[model samples]
Target: MISVFPEVSSQYLIGGEWKTSSKIKEVRNPAKITEFVGEVALCSETDVTQAVDAAENAFKAWSRTSVDERAKRMKEAAEKLSTVIEEHVSLFVRENGKTMVEAKKDLLRCVEVMSKGADTLLEWWKPVHVEGQAQKVQIRKRPRGVTAVISPWNSPMILTFKRAIPAILAGNTVVIKPATYCPLTVMSCLKIIESSFPPGVINIVTGSGSVVGEALCGDTRVRTIAFTGSTETGKKIMSLSSNSVKKLYMELGGNDPALILPDADLNEAAIKRIRLGILRASGQVCSAIKRVYVHESRYEEFVDKLKKEFERVVVGSGIQPDTTMGPLNNRSQFNFVKELLERSKQIGAQVESIGQKLDSASWEEGYFMLPSIVTNLSHDSELVRAEQFGPIIPVIPFADLDEAIEMANDTEFGLRASVWTSNETAAIDIADRLEAGAVFHNNHTVFQNLRLDFPGIKESGLSQETRWGGLELFTDCYGFAD
Candidate 1:
């Protein structure tokens, strides 16, 4: 067995202390399944009860602390966390199957979220004086007690902090449940930052979502639930939290589309960004460009360029320096993508499998596949309609802007969409008619869309995440009459 980060702590963090569970689960390296990464305690329902009890006990004192003091501690915690992020990059790659470069970026983003979340909290919590009344009145934000953060596996570290940081800054004690598939990196990061707050302010439990996840959402002690994952699981969380009427912030799945107008530029840099938007994390990201709509005049040219870009990719273990893309994170996702591709072929879709295998000799050892491009498919085909959640993309030709808009808006999901055109006026016009939470003018990817609030419409999600909207979700406004 190949050893990776064997010394890193993976125990459950409860009440500001590391505790062990009776049942243990082994962690495997997704890039090389036979290799052992580490182990995590499988917490039970009783553990969830104890963790929530501790949070309830601590919320009284922590919620009363000055907002300025909370912000100061969050900044300090982020600074301390930055110094240790580099040490766990390899562990992240082994446990999560992201390239070393992507792993580093994932860990580093946590610091930025924590620091910026604190800044947003300060800006959002200022007292607002309301006029036009006989007497003085002011509106202020108050903390929602005990937020439950359940994060997914694809980008675990940053997503957890994206919710947890603001909830804490708003004086809400939190109990976090990291994805069972990738818990080590999140546990390590949370362990490092737990010292900055009082006991029970930050707690984590590791186990199956069916066990720990349901408990966290259904528990009456929890006042709010912030989750990021598939729409199916988001629905389950809603049902569980509904009994208690908990405040819910859900960031669900998306089948995002990109429309390339005839006048759009397909330069080398632009093509590269488009490819990255589709292939990043092997398309495991929720907002990745799942399908593309190119004008009939430029459809052939765009497909040819994208095919060339796909051919240059090298898939293998993320730790290898020469590898550009890594394997799927787990066996379930790997199998799902394989079946989707096969179904596309059976239905007579033009599925072009391109890309070089970094190690053809050991290809069967991991959940690896060459990135594919699908063309000559109907808009309603499963390959074009489903999220896919893999490195398979469909490029459809649209005769006009109206046809393109109609095809893109035909999904139950309305998470994000993008339009590519030289004319800014044309781009805004299309964006206005698109049925998505956020629309981009030229480029649409994680980094390009981070500065603004991320909301989803229709079946995509409830509420929003990131920016001021995220901070506001963990709080409630109060009017003081004088």
Candidate 2:
């Protein structure tokens, strides 16, 4: 196998081996588009079929492998992952365009997610007992064959490994379909970690989602698909999987809200909203801070403070020292964000362009954009209603708490929201009303608590994940009483 740090391009990991294809796609560094990162071999539908076939064959034995053994192998993978983490850090910055701090956090978070799944698999995958008058009942969990993990480039490693590990721990084999733009990072990590598993147990097919993703989701042998991407793409996968009534685990888009109550701290709220909106993945995250709904009493104060903080954000190449954020990950995303900003102006939204570019000339060579703040937008405006997926913050003022809640819940997304206030009682009351899976009392975007459920309602996502629910997701429950 080639080194994790690729020179030009890398091969895919299929059936625990590196395989090649005739088609190759170029991967440019988003931080400096002129700099060639590498290339990745594109696989076809036949490759996806081969991967599913191998995973199906492997599942027969892997499913029966003891929990202790599976956990041990996963731990071994984690340890190996740490030893080579620096190489990953450097490569991640070059390929994905997230700052060094963000890249490091991404790597650590991925390890934490996978290790947590491995550590608790034995406890999470348990049989339940219920007593009755005549007979006792027991619920047993059974693996659901091969699981297809179709992961996106935004938080690629965390979402990919997090989705894949639970299914594998539940005794299901896995076929990974990584997004084309960031395939090398995932493929290299898998290359390092795949050694701990038996052949055919874990496989990956790299290519465009239109080809390989459809093939994996449509296959009858692939019983489950754990996906993390846009709601539109999730719908397509859902349709494809319906052919076989396959299980679908989706984490879709979000227009996440940050609401500031009348009694909120402007200093803290301003900083948190700015950081959450752009410092993370250039705001490409699915649950990023999308819209800000501040109490009209404090709207001007909050907006002014947020604009000042957003101005200081350091935008540059990811590998540079003291860089707070990096470029947009790809050309399509850059163009989309640019157009969104343009539309915000066309619709009469008050737009404030903020943020610093380290090298103004280098901006032309990279997919870089200074973060902008858009205010005075109606709830129905394109910038307010849609997921921009970039560093564009739309601040909308609400007259009362009820209006704030209404605006927060207006969207088709329910990933998360933040209620910034001092009073715990009011915070709880406000959080309870927001239509989202998780609510922060103050401000926090990305952190994992094993007990908390990471799910989305409405168009944001389907089904629940993390904690015990995640393990059960990969299994079909069966019980019988005598």
TM-scores of the models, in the given order? Answer: 0.97, 0.96
**Model 1 compared with the native: what TM-score?**
0.97
Model 2 lDDT per residue over 256-306, tens place: 998888988777555765576544788888888888888889888888888
Give the 10-residue window scoring lowest on summed lDDT in candidate 2: 1-10
- Compared with the true structure, all predictions reach lDDT values of 0.89, 0.83
List candidate 2 stretches off by more than 4 Å: 1-8, 268-270
Model 1 lDDT per residue over 370-461, tens place:
99999989998998999999999999998978989999999999999999889999999999999999888788875433435575898888
Candidate 1 residue pairs that clash: none
Best by lDDT: 1
Once all C-alphas are superposed, what RMSD does model 2 give against the true structure? Answer: 1.9
Best by TM-score: 1
Model 1 error, position 146 (Å): 0.5
Poorest 10 consecutive residues of model 1 by lDDT? 1-10
